[model samples]
Target: MQLENKVAVVTGASSGMGHAIVELFAREGAKVVAVARRKERLEELVASLADAPGEVAAYPGDVSSREVNEGMIDFAQKTFGGFDVLVNNAGIMDDMSPVGDATDEKYEQVMAVNVYGPLAAMRAAVNAFKASGTKGSIVNVASVGGMRSCAGAVYCASKAALISLTKNTAYMYMADGIRTNCIAPGGI
Candidate 1:
């Protein structure tokens, strides 16, 4: 059990990669907090993993809010009696609009979920890691478009910002033994 006894909080955990991560973590014996806005989906995920080696709890909320970001982290610590990893996987995509075609609303919404949410979560996680003296890990799930021009302007920009945030966090928190990294996964 690679994650035996570990406590992890995974955002956007109702579907896709987030969903899979939650399952894998629990299978490996980690206590996982699966967070997503879709209550039914989260409940389903928790129920499906009922017989896993570890435990899973559903936390229904929007990651775009600072409160939700902080709340999930707090919940993990309070519920599992420890905190070890935070996976920031919640995100939204912008329509394939170029810069001239991008709307302020689109940019704001994208940035809120893709960048700001992770930033807030990282801050909260670092504080928790410090208080607990645990060498922690933070995984920010980005898109390959962040490193290239394959995606819409707003989405690319949002993901780029997230990648930068990850690098900065990794450097800043290294001394504290809290590792941070970004994963820019993509598919056709």
Candidate 2:
């Protein structure tokens, strides 16, 4: 779909892959709502992308929090009118450890940021897309850990669940003109 004049919400956009995606989307003429936990980093990114085809606004908040995710979407709609795309890219990888050595805290942290975070964002985006009556796309950044068992046990399991959620949501939302897809990146 043409990205010109479109509105995109990208989580974890302060740094890493999320930042790159946000920059590219803006260059492609999509007004991007850059969401991340670090307000300063997001501001820097926005400054660097000032000359891009489309504009960008930074929304700093933790993606793992349901209130934050909902608020971000609401802010984006108020700012851009409606939503067209969502990039569920916020994630955190815990220290490599076997299942036997994994701590409950580590597991919970990883799942909250990497798995539940994206799910919450997707729910918000779906509602916005339906309300806008526009064809929408959701791009989830999963990991090779999801497709294979090579990653640390807890991380792998979280990503695998994310993959499953992506596919299921894709199937369920196809009839609604909303497309959901995932990218499983390998090595980083």
Candidate 3:
């Protein structure tokens, strides 16, 4: 197993890319703490992974909250021993409105979840690794929209900010045994 004995935290674990990453990580032998907003769905996800090589534990909450972000790390440490990987995969898209047509609420909501959420989670993870002297891996899921301008104003700008954060984290923490990288997937 590529991640035998590793413990991971995956946000947005009830659907889409987050769910997929949790399944893949479990198959590769990394115990996972799945974070999402839907308690029932999160429970279902954990149940479905019952026979995987590793394990899955559900923690339902909104990733945009710093407490929720830090709580995931604490759950990993308390449940699976320690944290080694974090997949910052939770995100929301805007209404595809141009900046001129966008509302302040949409802009704020998208940025809060996309940028600040990941930032808070990664911060907690990095601090955990530093304190425990553990080498860690952080995978920030960005988008091609982040690099270009395909997804309208709020989403595009939020993703762009995510990409920049990923780069900065990589450079800032590489020597500390925490390697950060981003995946800017195109389309599906």
TM-score to true structure, per model: 0.98, 0.97, 0.98
lDDT of 1 by residue, 17-64 (tens): 999999999999999999999999999999999999999999999989
lDDT of 3 by residue, 101-188 (tens): 9999999899989999999999999999999999999999999999999988999999999999999999999999899999999766
Model 3, position 157: C-alpha lDDT score: 95
RMSD (Cα, Å) for all candidates, in order, is 0.8, 1.2, 0.7
Candidate 3, overall lDDT?
0.94
lDDT of each: 0.95, 0.91, 0.94
Better of 2 and 3 by lDDT: 3
Which 10-residue window in model 1 sums to the lowest lDDT?
Answer: 179-188
TM-score sort, best first: 1, 3, 2
lDDT of 2 by residue, 6-70 (tens): 99999999989999999899999999999999999999999999999888999999988999889
The per-residue C-alpha lDDT of model 1 at residue 83 equals 95
Superior candidate under TM-score, 2 versus 3: 3
Candidate 2 has its poorest 10 consecutive residues by lDDT at 1-10
Off by over 4 Å in 3: none
Q: How many backbone clashes does candidate 1 have?
A: 0
